[model samples]
Target chain A: MEKEISDPTLTVSGQRGPASHERRIQIIKSAHEHFLQYGYKKTSVADLAKAIGVSSAYIYRFFESKQAIGEAICSVVLGKFVVALHELASSDMSASNRLRKLYITLLDMSLEMFFNERKLHDITIAAVEERWCTTTQYHQTKYEVITKIIQDGRASGEFERKTPLDEVVMAIVETLYPFSHPILLQHPILLEQSEPEVLHQRAIAVSNLVLRSLAP
Target chain B: MEKEISDPTLTVSGQRGPASHERRIQIIKSAHEHFLQYGYKKTSVADLAKAIGVSSAYIYRFFESKQAIGEAICSVVLGKFVVALHELASSDMSASNRLRKLYITLLDMSLEMFFNERKLHDITIAAVEERWCTTTQYHQTKYEVITKIIQDGRASGEFERKTPLDEVVMAIVETLYPFSHPILLQHPILLEQSEPEVLHQRAIAVSNLVLRSLAP
Candidate 1:
């Protein structure tokens, strides 16, 4: 799906200048801080405007809604995550080893957001529940990186070539849902069981299972 | 973990009369109706007592808290689900076929709850998020049924016996998380995409992959 970023000020017909770009960044920064402190659902667009010393109408020129600002914040966070995944996928490691690291990296990154950046984590949960474009777009990019890794693995005779590519990809993503998906990760039962050491062991075990299924 | 059912009236030392048993059933039924109408979180024990024309202290004799009443309601629902699973697991079908059926059944049942019994579905989601005993106990029973199916497959020489039984069981459960887990299923994005036909096709694909991995 196309990202729903309908900033009228940045449109081709409107053609806003560099100051508008700077203002957009400032709005996002202030919103991010307020959301982290008061929670995404609790903080209002009017509150964001007041904190930034601007009118609500002025903030509206840059982003359409509160969720739109949320999407902007999510893009920054999820985009960096996708970039890190791309780097790991293209690194000079065996396909099997790289796959293992990718799975572990996903768990570690989400865990970090949960424990260290908790309020931001709530925003992420909202992004997912509300189906924000940033969340969908991020998944799209992450899937491409995974596809590349799988194709590379097959080309190098590291994985079986018989199963259709999409099925394999879906299976892998579903299998890793407990670790990778934000809602599943925040599950109180899963949270209780997620000692760092215990999670490491389970991630390795799950990784090994995926590798076994992919073995040529 | 053991189920946290603390009904003081039901213990051997305090064996209540048959009237007490009837009162307990009445309490659960009234609570279930109110929970379905208003929601588990919204309904208070005092309201329940008022509805049933009993004192709050009398209600406490049967259940420790509001969550305990929620658990009793969940047990009735989830217990029926487990019984159905057990029947399916022992049915006269090939192990591979039975496993596929089990996966599809899980998806169908959860989707049924999501679409048809939406208010009750909210309670289930709360049960999972709160780590209610009913949810954990249900998962434990479901896992055992899955384990039994895998064991039968291995005994019949239909599945590879080399993978440790526990590892194979864990792998299968994790792979089926999207279909079976309440939190994952309630995700709005997933719900949007979960037309029955699409879900059926994906479940089949995932089951096929697992069966291929289990082949000797």
Candidate 2:
């Protein structure tokens, strides 16, 4: 189900007392870890507050609820993805080369997120499934960042002009999203004997298909 | 978590007594529904047992545990996928026409499975992630079916001799796999407002790319 965050008005840039901002960041980071470890259903707001050494009220003071905390976590991760793609687009590499790099980088980031922060990944999957905080400005901003990269590539004749940039971005996003969610990637029977190399090879093969499609 | 089924020996063939076989099929169907409704973690063996009007032990009598049930569920779904692909391959159509039909059929089948059999899709994602049942007889059977199609197309001079059939099959499977998993496609903030037409267009575009790569 899509989690609903009550305080859609909250912003990372909103004016706050220095101490309050610091505490909020602490709570968010702690909550991220807790959510990653126990998942959204199992990790309570109180658990996050306790982990951050703050009162539940303090957490509320910064955010509204567990769902709000989840939005923040997803925003942080997706924000990272956008920023990296933007950097790749701006680099001196050719459009096709840059796109390939972006694909590989995105895959690596997803794998890292899956292995390192499984709880947050789980929370993100829940958020995505439930359509939680999807209408929020934060998500729109991230989408724009991705769209801009494709637009830039097209404008510079780096990508095929006929291809729909927005659709390509969405497909790539959909393709890479599962690898970030450990719960989606963990196959019990396959895990018994499948080496990491095998999984990595599969990721590379998928990336190649996406990259091939995006090439000019 | 890797769901461990107790007796990995009970195959899905209508082998156990007729009553037992019918009961097993019913349990799998109920379990599939539960998986779709609550996901893998939230759907317990007890929940499945209750839904199927059987005791947990009765459920276990046919399969071993929740994980074993998951394996059976995925095997059933994937088995269907392989069968569909084989049918497409064996049809008396031109190679290019067969490829096109194969793409469209797979896409429709996958989307149907994703939306209708949510539980089976969830179990498959878990199976893929955990690397469980990777080298299973089912996958081998699937590979052979796909390879046969490519080999037939190649011998008929319908596809480029340089095209790697194994790689192409892998690409098709991997690309479609992500879309079949709801957790990847159902991002609330990122995809909640996303139009289905956009997704359809993206699928068509990617299929075209795959086809172009195989063209002689």
Name the candidate that leads on lDDT: 1
Residues B12-45 of candidate 1: C-alpha lDDT, one tens digit per residue: 1222335349888888899998888888888888
- A31 Cα displacement, candidate 1 (Å): 1.6
What is the interface RMSD, in angstroms, for predicted model 2?
A: 4.0
What are the TM-scores, per candidate, against the unseen true structure?
0.87, 0.70
Model 2 local distance difference test score: 0.60
Alpha-carbon runs more than 4 Å astray in model 2: A1-20, A32-40, A50-53, A130-196, A210-216, B1-78, B114-138, B152-158, B181-198
True contacts kept of each: 0.40, 0.30
DockQ of each: 0.48, 0.29
Docking class of 1: acceptable
lDDT of 2 at B182: 42
Which sections of candidate 1 miss by over 4 Å? Answer: A1-20, B1-20
Q: For model 2 chain A, where is the 10-residue window of minimal lDDT?
A: A1-10
**What local lDDT score does residue A197 receive in model 2, on the 0 to 100 scale?**
65
lDDT of 1 by residue, A1-216 (tens): 112222212111122235349888888899988988888988888998998899998988877688878887777787767767767776889888889998799989888777876788678888777777677766766677678778889988999999999988877766677787888886546777668776776777778778887888
